[model samples]
Target chain A: MSARDTILARVRDAALARPEAATNREAQVAERMTVGPKGIIPHQGQATGPQKLRQFLEKLEANDTTVTRVSSEDEIAHAVARELRKRNLPAAIRMGEDPMFHAQDWGSLDVSRGPGRLEEPVTLSRAQFAIAETGTLVLTSGPDNPVTLTFLGETHFVVLRTEDLRSGFEDMWGDFRKRGLDPRTVNMVSGPSRSADIGQVLQLGAHGPVALHLFMVG
Target chain B: MSGHVPTSSAFKSNSQEALVNRNLQAALRGSRGNFIAKRAAARANVPEFDDIRDQARDMKNHVLANLDLYLEAYEKKVTEAGGHVHWAETAEDARRIVLDICRKSNAKTVNKGKTMISEECGINDHLAENGIKPVETDLGEYIIQLRGEIPSHIIAPAVHVTVPEIEEAFRKHHAHLPPDRDLSELASLQAEARSELRAKYFEAEVGITGANMLIAETGQSVIVTNEGNGDLSQSLPKVHIVMASLEKIVPTLEDSATLLRLLARSATGQEMSVYTTFSSGPKRSEDPDGPEEYHVVLLDNGRSNMIGTEFEEMLRCIRCGACMNHCPVYQSVGGHAYGWVYPGPMGAVLTPSLIGVEEGGQLPNASTFCGRCEAVCPMRIPLPKMMRSWREREFEKNLTPSATRYGLGVWAWAAQRPWAYRLAARIANRSLGITGKSKFSKLPLAGGWTKFRDFPAPQGGTFMDQWKAGKR
Candidate 1:
């Protein structure tokens, strides 16, 4: 065996020799109650991730969540205001001193795009996505947008293009490395913020979002 | 969560009652369900979970083996990066080092993230006693701290506490609020905490947080949390202190990534937490944000003793609270009944090492030899065997009671003479068969089993006797 295998073997041998821990093992199986996760809609055939995301946004719009296609952050600002009012959750989008976020006029939206204020929900601009095979959103922190945006809101709406959903984390990080973008913090949003902290009872919107609407536009 | 941990004398007398409390059954059932399912879901998604854990464990162990070299290298790198590294041999030294730094900076108050080492050292109590109020910035920790209670769980400190209790605590503490409102609004309570913590964050002078992993290659620290308090604690203060065990060092960023991937999934089953941050030294020259002064306090309360022993693998612990989550005893008692800061199976094994078993003895015997803890441990710390070793340590030191020694010694003496032992087992089983009826209605001996109910009587005949009779 090579040195890697040799070290691993030693560790494995050490572990197997350990005395078995005996806790209450009295179990008669119960059937697990879960519906297999709802598979995302439609097919892209041979198209890239962008095509799949475009299809996903169409699905969301079909489910009453709309999308606003944009070339710049200005349209994103407008879309966010429209979506928040539609969902009955107020918008408190904050803007920072970064030239990228501040360049957008924010279009009469109830906004504050800097450091998030306490007790108010916010929809700050996102840089990009590391979309999963499933529709998971990956947002990282840099000079433009920090880590707080993803956490502080009761409702989070990310406006990324369909083409932005790369293959997976490994694929995205590889691309990030190639671009020399030393990403410090990368956050992935699946559904909404959730917690079971109290009595194993499922309570959504524990600390963050209860409703997450993805407004993906091409 | 006790008004305070009862004095050792009081605790020794009341341990039985503490374990048999009215709420014990409820707490155990609630805790056992959550962690078991969490681990199941986590493992289901990542079938390579065990392999990932193994790689991460070895990575940590390899770093520790060359710890002196890496530590010296880290110090050099830290100084090069304009950060300060302090070595604390003892809790008092760690405290004094932090206190002196706080004093130098003219700090009146400090906002703190949950650091078990700091908790182990009772830093908050020490700081508070010296009139420097240290506020716990994490929401769960902050709530428990305000209530003047010890954390009942490692990751979720206030896990055992109900919403109503929290509501009452808030009602009493949130003095400026209207007292007669419906308390169903949890977001408002969270908002209240945020606003309260927000003021402390802005007003506090020094901030202290724990590093989940310390990257040796870059001389940096990483903390992963959803509440976003670690960042605030590190950034808002003029001086930021990262208190971490010497065991928390990883070799490289790539290694840190592998561990981070395992951590959140193993912990709360998140793909990655909302915040997985890295802070190296103080603010850079071009950077306008971050702490002006960064200090890393490397603590080894008694960890070095494990570096080259059967228990050396215990140092590979990542503090993910996975083992504790699945710990049956911890689930039953919650953390407070363990009577030390570290609770669960990991604590049962680790506490004895740090605080002399002589001071906090009997903790090692608290488990029922349940293997779930070892099964779920990412590092695969041989918790039961280590705990048994600790019990052996107690026995060797004569810390066990005289009655236990006499009884066990008599049993051993009888067992050596197989015929006599067999005869005794036959008699005992017969008697149990009579008096026990269906089961042992009342057990005369055995402290743990009898305290709740009777142990089931053994089968009527000895195995040897039954075998011989059947052969005939």
Candidate 2:
């Protein structure tokens, strides 16, 4: 027998070993796969709009991710430029072909549309959704928003709309399903890359972006 | 060289050596309350932490109860997503399957993420013996790999290596670099490691990682990392092989989310890890970057027999390392003393289950039954109870030492007869009350206890006798 058959058979045996055999195992599993049950949603992430935006900013700061709120989408480019200048980084950024990003006036900033490169000083991606519960940025992989840019950039700049901010994973996943884009990867990034491997001292920028600056288009 | 062979049978001696090893003791002391305090603060910050833990436990239990069915569904989804799943009954099977994949991919060097599953299967040594270089990407794992030692701690693999010791290892290994380079700061050390690993990540042909959660709903393997090395490891290689066991499966994305809420907080006190990447399969046809081939090796290595047995609860482990963090014995002696792939209270119960009661029995015996492990366990695994079960099994098998068994026999016999118990208790108390004076500095047949501190004498009599006398 194949290893799969052998292992599955043993699992079946073990489940049946009990006095009350696990009946309807396949049916129950099928039902669960189709109708995925929603477990307890944390009350912490139940707020909406301004209330959630405040919570989201607080949580994002707690993770060392800086956020700048812009009153309109047109200000996103200026905010990104300002952040880059403040950090003394090059005025160059890479991004994908997201129409939301293209609609902005870049104002002579060097912007490339493709995947990430090794020396990319800064890369921008529009967050599909932001979770208020943990201040996580959810980015999907595609031509419009390549996932490599999320990890490859030395300093990552993300554009999130206040309206797209979610309270928790359950709500965010619901939105994802409605959007109906099945990207290869769904990255839920919370903060700058860090490691406590050496003497348990928390050090940032251990392989991913050292700084994650969020441009919140409120 | 091969992987470190199991020295679990000599755990007694190993712990004894660990207690006095100055460097190990210093490292343990430095990190003693860090995890405990962080977990406490994280728990306090979340109002619904316990509720989430409960939901997570229920989800895991539900999946385990119907593992066969879920595995089937998971396989179907993975196949639909253009991925392959290989089933391995033992460590050898896993190693063979992985080797076959690497050979097919023509891999010379493979970058690795931190995966306890690979350690359990001894994948690194197997790959090396077969002429493939396995580069550990996680900083802690890399440090320990350089030292040629098993991880002293799970999450913090090089926790036992002091800062100076790390410097020594780096200097000795990276001799090609400038010898006089300033390695004084932790920042400098991190930069060096980052630069070294960045080059290797791009050069590797295959990247192997361990899955934190396997979602049967979408055929996705989720990995949670703070360092982001797991992402690079999987993303850069031509073939990405996820080393996971059958029990890592969760029913849906929602189920994974519930567990994720508990995971980072319980392990590292983070609201969420920096990177929680969910990779379903290889890159899409239009994707700019990602691996082309995706394979998941589903290892069973004795987990199958654990189902429906008393020890089945061990399968719920998510490899969070929280149990070891909160384990008092572990904090004192450290992880290497457990003498195997796993250590601490979780290891105490799990080691025996995975590798029989003979070689791994001493691990369960090492526990103090403080119940701290179970208290801090996110999945609510009753660790102390299972350790007690192992002790019982050891006794039934006559694997327990004769002295302990005889002593327990005497105590049990005396307790069964109230009159005899009281008579003996009174005699012992009177003798100790008179001879001990304030406390017994020395005692027959208890040098182990008296060597560290004096044993306090009984005040008057046993608690039962005192209670009866007070009533009268």
Candidate 3:
């Protein structure tokens, strides 16, 4: 016995072949199974830099978010048009068109373009700062770039630059093999835009972007 | 025009009012922030990704302990490569063997290429309730099949619709003849969904896919894509089925290139996902854009009762939404709030054992045991000890919650007395800190743990009042 106890004795013989249809919450989750545990939640080993992952996305947006650093991708696209004009919202900026991110410094970053359709909410700049250990992003997809202007937006304003982060995923896959880069798609969005399909109900911009506004520059 | 919206047989008739619905908490809040940061960026990119998830769970329990001698060496390498290997064992004998091979290859129309076992055999509402048009030619499932909806995200299936609701679902499903369009033109919504799905890929006689790894030394299947629509739904079809399920086999092209370098870096943090292919069968004899006829069905549906079981390390899942991208309850409830067709933490433990833990067991009590989906499961599938064995089969079948069976039956009878559970948590923490003015929001029958969130207030003293005020 064991391919975990024959997958929990075939879920306790299909919850004892259905006793008033199984729920004494799935025969107490069929006598509480456990087999080899540990999965993930460690990365707080620290390494956020794009000015501490843009002051932890402006102190999780609007919370004493302090940061003092600037180098340029056009001054992090004028600090993302001054944080989407405090919050009036409407911008479509899209430029990676590649020259190895315009061969560094002011690579281009006024992102606003959006729509890969999970119900529509836009934000599309793939870099300025990336690597909170490995939520990794530093996109470059080219042809004056139109990969849904960085995955059809719903609040996806990335711009990272604490000397472009990278401590993991083989240190930004050795900067995509020392800058040949454009193998076309690179969308490392860390949060927001979600779905559990309807019965597990926990929806947010369903197909993409419910929130992920980063802006780190150094 | 069967635009694919079907999954409602309601999980097949009320899997408990579709797991207590309020639009499944808006599809579990867009599947809890991309499976909690894609299993915290695949557990900071392999710190021996939990000992390479126990050697890919002993290579999927050594290919499900020799599943019929690796399905007769994957049907003798798909009939020595000309291809055509079928086997159903149910979803009505794999939709009556793909509607008798699309009515003996006459097939009116079909394009699809994102086959989660043709969304667990509902097969575009059984080939559009049998009339047959079936399109979903994947571009986030052709904008959630032109806004009819479902498939909210599993390697990005319209990850919860946004972009001015995909520019009002392409101005209400692209109402012909443009008018100042340019919603960042996306090649004019990919040339009006390729002139309405390039006539179902050249009046398709048949083309349907969904393999993402199958091999067993040679019967090849693999599919990882960025859109060459699984190679134009298997080289502009004359018939190509494929479906898949028996824990998507493995055993060589160097064990599926070590599961395709851990499947496009635990899916979409990317090292390679722009079309991965590896087809190997129908199109040989000096090929030239293949498929004159190639079948491959394979289903098992319940996966041979998870071959030996602790829920068979959820058949070493490679779905890699990295446990609903790092579940904080699949990021505030998403994937149609886990009603079924497998959503987050591998559909809360394979939909209470494939649609039945009393018909979709309260999806392993939604969850907060939060071990960030067994630290990013490249195949490490522990998932908070399988959501505490579905809360120990919902507390040994009394289906719990009579105020959680009177609060875990008076905290398991004052947890077998540590001085009557520390004098009933020190007189319920000094009557909830003198009627919670120290604020835990509000309590009593713990208003379902302070409604949506915020439940802090206990530090005024305890771990036995900070261990007897730090050892007196």
Per-residue lDDT for A127 in model 2?
89
Judging by DockQ, tell me the better candidate of 2 and 3: 2
Who is ahead in lDDT, 1 or 2?
2
Q: A71-179, model 3: which lDDT tens digit per residue?
A: 6555665666666666566544444344434544432434322223322344444452354442444454334333333434446565566666654333454455456
* Every candidate's lDDT: 0.66, 0.89, 0.58
Residues B1-472 of candidate 1: C-alpha lDDT, one tens digit per residue: 2113423222344355556675545655655666667667866766566776777776676565555545655677677778898877667777888888888999889989778888877788778777898999777788788788777677788787666667778789888877886667665666666667766777788999998988765677888766667766777678999998878877655566567657766677655555566667776543434577999888877776566566677888888888778776666566777777777788777877777777556777778897888888777678899888888888999988998899889999998999889899888778877764666545667755766776877765777888889954
**In candidate 3 chain A, what residue range of length 10 has the lowest lDDT sum?**
A29-38
Q: Which scores better on TM-score, 1 or 2?
A: 2
The TM-score obtained by chain A of candidate 1 when compared with the true chain A: 0.63
Worst 10 residues of 2 chain B by lDDT: B1-10
Candidate 1, residue B124: the lDDT equals 85
Please give the lDDT score at residue B189 for candidate 1.
Answer: 65
Predicted model with the maximum DockQ: 2
Docking class of 2: medium
- Candidate 2 colliding pairs: none
